[model samples]
Target: MIIVTTRQMQQMDKNTIESFGIPGRVLMENAGRGAIEMLSEHFDLEGARVAVVAGRGNNGGDGFVIGRYLMEMGVSVSFFLLSTRDRVQGDAGANMDLILDLLAEHALSQFIEIPDKDALEAVTEILLDHDLFVDAIFGTGLNADVRGIYRDVIELINDSDKAVFSVDIPSGINADTGAVCGVAIRADATATFAFAKAGHILYPGNFHTGDLEVVDIGIPGHIAKAQSPHIFLPEPHDIAGLIPARAFNAHKGSFGHLLVLAGSPGKTGAAALCANAAMRSGAGLVTLGVPEKLMPVMEPMVVEPMTTALAQTSSGGLDAAALDDIITLLADKAALALGPGMGTDSGTQELIKSILAIASVPMVIDADGLNCIAKNPDILATVKAPVILTPHPGEMARLTGKTTADIQQNRMETARNFAEKQKVILVLKGAQTLVAYPDGAVFICPTGNPGMACGGMGDVLTGMIAAFLAQDLSPESAALAGVYLHGLCGDLLAEDHAFGFSASDMVAGIPQALTTLLS
Candidate 1:
């Protein structure tokens, strides 16, 4: 599904009204009707007590239209206008006028004109008694912090213990960035127009926008296509297309070999997980190159992938001297998975630097490998091989010299800037994993849940990406497919269990997730 910014959506709306000749009022009516359709499906509108908290904007017009439809359905709706009737203009004014006439002719139970904070406070108790609320006080265009009477009313509605259905988006959310503008309504569900906004999927704002339903309000397909939304939420079929077809007669050698350089004195689990995950991801021959002393530790832990000992430092971590051994191993390897469980010793960092300087195969650097390069990111520009760096927010901060908060606040831009500058595929791992390419294309993975926030997950991901690369998928395709399949596994597992599923559990789910793609 296309995830659009506020500007892109607004422009699409403009083009729909101006170029496509769809009247603005017709769109408003369609939006309100579609929202009502979704609302009716989930809620019983007949004889139910509901309040429509309306502003003077187009979003408010939607609320006004909804109020009329609810009244027609025998739903007792209280229209709480944030501004006087005369203050509402454009399409909203037209709808408000119709609602006012209908309310008087039918002698409706309520119409509270809350023009100021004092007016809103007077009706707080009355609003609390309503069974449901329709929040149309603000929409996606709101960029500044919500204040005055609107803020107090929002607080009152939240405290009411009643379910709220938001129009377009929750009030006080920045549609483009997904940042909450001071405070926002925690809606039980949101009925959006045409396409899903970025705020509906991005965090903090996503918390406020519950159960999003994108309503088709007659925005032309051509207009939306012309806008060319860059962000997307990939579906199963989309990911399935990225997976390369395996020939029936293909042999192990035909699949490709993956080399995993990981493990330390006491961190054999990370190395074992990385190499084993590669085997699961269809890499023909997976090998682990660990510190010579740690060979026995990983050799017994992982049975499928062959293990080779590398020159080690005194602490039993692979050192720069291991580069010669790694080169020898890489001769048969189609791809490399580096950095997991590799301790951050100076010698280990040197080994990472040496590998990057001359490594010919596609490589995925994760965990401590990312840390080593964060110390001297200039080495990224010097690497000749195709590179993929998977980092959580903290590692990303260290790499780009920005605070973790800054990276989180602007994930797409931060990842994009680094990928473009370093000429590497960047996978920003977190709640919503983003795969960014040097060409400015960014794919957001909507799969995965809080259950995925565990250790060894990144290591598994490192191996998965390397496996895809080994199978001859492009770096961008491999990174995107890896992140999607990884998250899909967690999402599937989440259906049966709330937590306690380990990275190993995720590894086990890989084949099932791949099957889901074909299904």
Candidate 2:
């Protein structure tokens, strides 16, 4: 599903209103009606008292529409306008007038104007008496910190312990970054119009967004397509479609061979996990290449993957002398998984540079492999094949010469800018793993959990991506599928246990994850 930024969504709304000729009021009505439907589905509206806390904006206009509908349905409704009746202008003011007319005719509902803090305090007890709170104060345009009576109103609603439903987005949540603006309403659910915004899926905003329901507010498909949203949330069907069907008559050679260069004296487990995960992810064959000193250790640890011993440095890492042998080993390989446990010794770094200079297949670089390149990132420019860099925040920070905080603060931009500039597929692994392409398109993986935070998890991911590459999936498909599957595995384990599931456990769960995804 395409995820839009606030600006893109705004442009889409503008295009629909001005170009497609859908009036703003009609859209607002549709949004309000859809939100009411969602609320009815989630909560018991019969004999319910709903407080429609509204601002003097289009979002507030949506609240007015909802309140009018609620009154028509025989539900007790109250409108608490943050601004005075005259100050409510535009479509919002018009809708407020309609609500006023309905109330004047029937005297069924109450309309309270609390434009200042004193009025807000005067009605504080009345506000908490409602069965539900409809948050329509702010929408996707919120950027700065929320303060004044607006803050106090949000706090009251949050403390009310009543079922709160947000409109478009939760009030006081930054619709673009998902950052909390001072304080935000933790809604029981949020009804977003047209499409899910970036804030709805990203970080803290997602936490506050609750059970999100995307309401079709009459935005034309052509208008949405014209926006050309580059960010996406990968659904199960999308990832399932990427997996190639296996041939009935195929043998080991049909799937493709994966060559993994990993392992050091103490990090042999990393290589084992990578090679094992490759086999689990459907690689035809896997060859675990390690320093000569670790051969005996790796040979006994792994059963399916064949192991090759390369020349070793004094520190027991792959040596620069192993370059010729490593290149020869890549002759029949389908893809390369590099830098999992490989240390950053001088010889190993040289070996990494040498391999990149001459390798002729797709490569999934991670861990120390990424670290080696961070020392001389320009080596990525010299590569001839499709390369996927799997970097955690720290590694990404090192590669870009920025702090880890900087990378985390703006993960989307950081990933997109780096991928576009470097001309490589970049997987920024974290909470919502991002798969960024050289063309600037980014896909967010919503799978995985905190339990997968343990060591060797990324190594498993490296193997998964390399296996997909070996299966003839494009660099983009491999990265997207791999990240999604990796997270799904963790999620599957999380269903049974919250945390403490190891990377080995994740590897064991790969087939089950694939089954769950494809089935």
For model 1, residues 193-230, the per-residue Cα lDDT tens digits are 99898888888888999999999999877778887527
**Error in Å for residue 512 of model 2:** 1.9
Q: Rate the local accuracy (lDDT) of all candidates.
A: 0.88, 0.92
lDDT of 2 by residue, 247-361 (tens): 8998889999999999999999999999999999999999999999898889988999999999988999889999989888999999999999999999999999989989989
Worst 10 residues of 1 by lDDT: 103-112
lDDT minimum window of 10 residues, candidate 2 = 222-231
Question: Which pairs of residues have clashing backbones in candidate 1?
Answer: none
Candidate 1: residue 431 lDDT (0-100): 85
Model 1 regions lying over 4 Å from their true place: none
Residue pairs clashing, model 2: 448-487
What's the TM-score of every candidate structure? 0.93, 0.97
Which parts of model 2 are misplaced by more than 4 Å? none
